[model samples]
Target: MSSILHVELAAEPAAAGRSRRVTGRWLTSLCGAEQPCATAQDLVLAVNEAVSNSAEHAYRGDPSGVVVLHGTADGPRVELEVSDHGRWRDPPADNGFRGRGLDMIEAVAEDVRVERGPRGTTVTFCGTLGQCSGTCEP
Candidate 1:
């Protein structure tokens, strides 16, 4: 069986937290567990980073921009995509504490893909629950 969730909201700093909360809830229900396990928790963190990046860099000076988060859980596999309609912006030079979102996402997710075009930017993250040591089971 498969389960899916979609969320669309203004591209603001708050969107990241909202996406995390919604994704966490959806994952828990989809996994049929009281709460997501360690691997699933890592996936939620990746989802937060993706939405946070879009909220911070995608819109630049435009507060009217929006972000879309879509996720699916199929068997032991999970996939999430976060997209924005604004142009993509390269991460700024590190100040010692910044520019680590993409790196963190790549570290936690089993597979990651990013696409950018005139229409928008989309980041996809995929991971398998079974990759963890029996933590995903309810």
Candidate 2:
């Protein structure tokens, strides 16, 4: 059996928090009975980072952009995809702070994929319940 959820929000800082909460609630209802709390938390964190990146970089200085979040739970794994219909920009050089969202997403997710094109950018990540023990290879 598989379950899926989707949400669309304005590309803004506040939307990141709202996305996180919605994703967390969906994951809890879908996996909380069997998946570990830590696993769920990790997945939620990854989604949060993805959304934050979109809000911060994808549509920089523009709040009119849109972000779409899709989540699916199948068997023992959960997959999330966050997409923005805006041009992509390279992460800025670290001057002391910032530029850690991608790193943090990779750390928490068992699998991560990023794609950019003229139309938009999409980040997809997945995590397994009680399965991963070490760093997940690309």
Candidate 3:
């Protein structure tokens, strides 16, 4: 079985929390009664990092910008894409306190891809559902 979800929100710091909540609910529904806590945590963390990066760096703290999140659950795996419409910016200096979002995302997600172009940056991540190793038929 397959399930999908999409969401778009203002590129504001506050939107990050809202995005996490929405995504978590959707994931729970798609995963059915399996309750894959670890997978859910990883997916939420990855999505939050991607969204936060757009709100903080892409728009440079401009809440007027926008962030788009797309999710797909195919069989035993789930994929998520988070995109922004603003230009991409380099991470902060090593000594900076907030340059580790990408690193944290990479650590949690099974696969991570980042693309940047004139229009903006997009992050795509995927991982297998904890309770559905071969298929997510429920």
Candidate 4:
């Protein structure tokens, strides 16, 4: 059976750190030995990056902003959603800084989706988990 975890927290640097730790623990508990060492590491890195994006770009760095995380861990498939209650935009083609983090997330995730508008931004990532394979190859 699949499960889902949904949560919201302050979009601050400190909160970002906390979210990373929490996600690591949660993934470990949920996947156990079925999740390989390398897979765990990648998940951790991806979670941290997502949280960092929320803190840095969410609300454009507003002190009281909040980011929401929701996802599921079921057997070999783990999915996550990181959302910010802030503004979002497609960076100008001429702009160099453009969507690097979102791009990075897409590269790491086997499947990804993004929703952007005046209300907020949400980035979702998912990959497979294997008992004998901890790393994703693609």
Candidate 5:
């Protein structure tokens, strides 16, 4: 069986934390066990980064932007997509202590896709739910 989690929140600073908490709970329930899936923490971390990115950069100075978080788990695979309707922002040239979110997401997820257009941006992260197989390296 497959399970889905969907949440839409204003693109604000606190949205990241809210998304993380909701995702954690959804993962725990989806696992159907006392503890969440083995990779749940990593998944949540990656998701937080995505939501944070949207909350920080998507709307620019506008506060009316909306960010959507959608997740699905089926069998051994889990996929999440974080999207925003606001215009995309180019990363600053001198990102001294930031701009590592995409790299971090790529590290944890087996597959990552980012789409940007007039409509907005959507970042998708996909990975296995349990222990890594031959495809994943420690």
Candidate 6:
């Protein structure tokens, strides 16, 4: 019995807590208390990166954007998405911005998906939670 928790937040600098809390709630629903810790941390980091991108790149730090996140606990998988209505600029040529946030997200997550365009960008990731026994917890 898997379930989904969907959250929508304003793409402001302050939404960080809201973002984290959403991830936490979803993990609690999906993984309970113990083993989900690491999985939940991954979710937190990924969402943080995505939201930072939304706030800094999407609206270009001016705000006036919305970040919509959805977390799903499916069989052996936990999925997440961060979406906003801000355009995506090309990353610096020399790979200079540091940290490789996107790469880290992809590395830790089992699957990653990105949708980008002139209007906005949406980043999504999914990975196994807990024992990952081909069946998710809820």
Question: Candidate 1's residue-wise lDDT over 26-128, tens digit each?
Answer: 7766666676777788889999998988898889969899999998887778899999998977665764788888889999987899999988899999877
lDDT of 2 by residue, 41-123 (tens): 78889888999888888887786899999988777677899999898987657646877888899998877999999989999
Estimate every model's Cα lDDT from 0 to 1: 0.84, 0.80, 0.81, 0.71, 0.82, 0.74
Best-matching candidate per lDDT? 1
Better-scoring candidate (lDDT), 1 or 3: 1
Residue ranges of candidate 5 with Cα displaced over 4 Å: 131-138
Q: Give the Cα-based TM-score of candidate 4 against the true structure.
A: 0.79
Candidate rank order under TM-score: 1, 5, 3, 2, 6, 4
TM-score computed on alpha carbons, candidate 5? 0.87
lDDT of 5 at 53: 93
Residue 116 displacement (Å), model 1: 1.2
Judged by whole-model lDDT over C-alpha atoms, candidate 4 comes out at 0.71
Q: State which candidate has the highest TM-score.
A: 1
How much RMSD separates candidate 3 from the native structure? 3.4
Order of all candidates by lDDT, from best down to worst? 1, 5, 3, 2, 6, 4
Residue-wise lDDT of candidate 5 within 46-111, one digit each (tens)? 899999999999898688999999999886677999999888778889989999999899987768
Candidate 6 per-residue lDDT, tens place, 23-48, comes to 76667566655334666777788887
Q: Looking at model 4, report the run of 10 residues with the lowest lDDT sum.
A: 129-138
Instruction: Give the better candidate number (4 or 5) by lDDT.
Output: 5
Cα displacement (angstroms), candidate 1, residue 1, comes to 11
Candidate 5 collision pairs? none
Off by over 4 Å in 1: 93-95, 130-134
Encode model 3's per-residue lDDT on 1-138: one tens digit a residue: 238888898988887998899888777666664453667767899999999888877887665899999999887688999999899877546646767888899998877999999999999998776454333332
